[model samples]
Target: MPTVTPKTAGPDMSSPKTQILAALRRASWISGQALADAAGISRAAIWKHIHALRREGYTIQASSGRGYRLEHAPDHLSPEGVHAGLQTELLGRNLICRRSIDSTQNLAKSLGRQGAPEGTAVLAENQTQGRGRRGRSWASIPHGVAVSLILRPKTSPDKAPHFPLLAGTALARAVSRVCGIWPGLKWPNDLLISGRKVIGILAELEAEMDRISAIYLGIGLNINAEAEDIPPDLASVATSLRIQAGRKIDRLDLVRALLEELEAAYYAYRLQGFGPIREAWKEHNITLGRQVRISSGREIITGTAVDINEDGALRVRTEEQELVTVSAGDVQLCPAV
Candidate 1:
């Protein structure tokens, strides 16, 4: 991840509630008058905001002389909670968080059509109609991470296929930083730890013949789920950070780290091109140099995974000494016979 200045880091301070929270965080307690002056709001408005924060699960203590003190903050992923200490340039600045939604991708696409700015994000605690590659159903538990990002990049439509690889590399870096365990990238957009799937990425694009309009990148990561939370059909193939680490992980910290890393990757790609991201992806990749089978539509190709090209296509060396580039497919590791 690229390093940013303090000016561009941390939560947006323009929000009155965020400003008050920052003030309170700076000190043990803040006087009502002082908070009002700092927030540029009246004392009554300050009180009202304080009440709203309390309703959102912040334990605030009030006293006649001490004013207001923050006792505790819940672990919820509300907009206010996520913005408390989040550091990013554009991503997560304009965020929409929900307790439950049908799909973050759907909401993100809808927002994109409405001319939502690039770097807008939609997050949900649970997704009822979550989807994966090839229109497969994705199971989303409440403890997992379900978020979609809307991006408008000034690039050609031909480069859109590389977005998933970009997202996967960023996610791998973030998970390694937060979980203390490095995950291997399975070609295209899956992250695996201990040979089990931990994260999946999907990218939907809107484009014309030559120009690209919007890209909605959806990411689902298993953060704090247990073995029992895994669906029966997916039990053998899916795993979570908690199951692997043997301890619960903080979702808010992980989400913040993800946004920051993603922002860095996005800017790097825009300025420096896909060379940096491709190298990073290769460093953590597990598919290359292995024998595999890929199913693209009704055709099946069995070959040795050779490399990924600049356009994010998987290069494979078939048994007949044929080198093929696959742009879309479902991959499976073939057992050596």
Candidate 2:
């Protein structure tokens, strides 16, 4: 039996199991009597929480003499695990961890409306009704990173549209740093590794006139999914960090890194403006200076993506020598002439 470590508890973290895990995290194991005394609960109560933790995919080894040791941590995302080594001030200050949910975005939006604090993170192990852009179904995976964040920025609602682009920039940097694999950014909100999609981001604004009440930023990153786990249609287009890196990445570590990067990027935007974010996005993006086709509603325009403007819109030099700035569209690299 391991005793829970004592740390600053998070909101809604009053459960006995959370405390027990915190204690176990501090060390491999403690005596059963020690755990009971530390948690101020009986040995039977400690055993009950231990059983629940095991059910959630944690491999705890309990012996008559050796007490309990954490042989293996859970593959699934737990708040205790994610927050264990998190390094951030505002971002992920309060985290909502769920075993299964319809969508993190939905819950995040609900929480935002209810005035959830800024930087509150909603994470789910599995999302049954996840969504991408244009109401497309986001494919779910067992060990994927499905998280949504709530941000209340002081900027105008006009800047709301650029949040997704900012997210893409942060995401690429985080992945590159954590997994040691550099990913290229597609226009707006897609991350590709070796020209295959690995992450998708969506940002929605809840605004009142010119003021933005909250921004619900949802991100889905393929971390440890096997090839067979991907859909037939997506096999050629999608990939996971595990598949690319040839090893399973620790989701908790990745999550912490991503949140830190995102927070830094957001703060930079507020303090310095969008110039730094735009520049970073350009450095990692694969769409610029490439022959491209943009599909916006009923019209299709073919051009060369030359630049992204200050407002985060894509600037294209069309085939006819005309310049067009596209604020929203699906961009595709055209076949070389």
Candidate 3:
């Protein structure tokens, strides 16, 4: 079963409470009869919704005769709300939302194959089966940024790996811009904040073995969730923007900025090749010039990221006097190195 995101603030929009609140917002002094009729629910249901909305920080005025008045509504995640918060045309032109999903990336891939445009986006409040690189799980903290962008690129299959690196870099830039914290790229797709994992990105592409069809880029960031909110396994490593910025950020605003950066970085990557994107990636990369270990399949290669190559591969100069290019691997830093 798909996970249902608990309503930490307001009631889920799909719930009857939101219907009551929305009705109140639509008209003042909404009579119980009117509200119930409008919502197609019982009068008792109307009262329940009113009480629930009030509990969720909605300022609802109630009167014996005048019925109910909605003074304020809890912020909603409407596409119009998110897009209005955005200033670019590259990230969220088309949006799809699900209450629960196995994975937003899988959903986005389905959309991409059906000819969803370049900026098509799929977002879920929670994921039942969210994943990261190498098929590892990414714990989706409810109300954070769990998004998948489906893009149909004009590039070949061999160059697809570079997109993950570029996407990771774009996310780092977006987080820095919104939260005012400098994050580092661990490799192709991990965001480190204060030397701990804060974000996970996974890139999946559909191809005909040699030609590319579409790419499903997934990014999951910890936001608003407290330190204790992280699971026991990730608590020691993963961090959230709220934890770092000292406040809950407006997710809509941050998402807008992230998509803009992704679009621009993707454009640059296609136009000028990975050289320029690599430079941008290196500037925010903490692994560069630092001692690190790369785990590829089974063998472990330790070295410094003297440079990232034109193809987005890491060029590590090992202590064994071997300069190795690892296309895909797990990166780690030796303690004290």
Candidate number with the higher lDDT (1 or 3): 1
Task: Give lDDT tens digits, candidate 2, residues 211-287.
Answer: 98999999999999989898889898899998998898988878988888888788788877888888889989999
The segments of candidate 3 whose C-alpha lies over 4 angstroms from its true place after superposition are 1-76
Instruction: Give the Å shift of residue 78 in candidate 3.
Output: 2.3
Predicted candidate 1 versus true structure: per-residue lDDT over 7-34, tens digit per residue: 3644334577876776776679889998
Q: Which ten residues in a row have the lowest lDDT in candidate 3?
A: 1-10
Ranked candidates (TM-score, high to low): 1, 2, 3
TM-score of each: 0.90, 0.84, 0.77
- What CA root-mean-square deviation does each model show from the true structure? 2.7, 5.5, 8.7
Select the stronger candidate by TM-score from 1 and 3: 1
Query: Which is the leading candidate under lDDT?
Result: 1
Q: Residue 227 of candidate 2: its Cα lDDT?
A: 90
Residue 267, model 2: lDDT of 79
Error of 1 at 144 (Å): 1.4
lDDT per model, in order? Answer: 0.87, 0.84, 0.76
Q: Judging by TM-score against the true structure, name the best candidate.
A: 1
Off by over 4 Å in 1: 1-13, 22-47, 61-71, 335-337
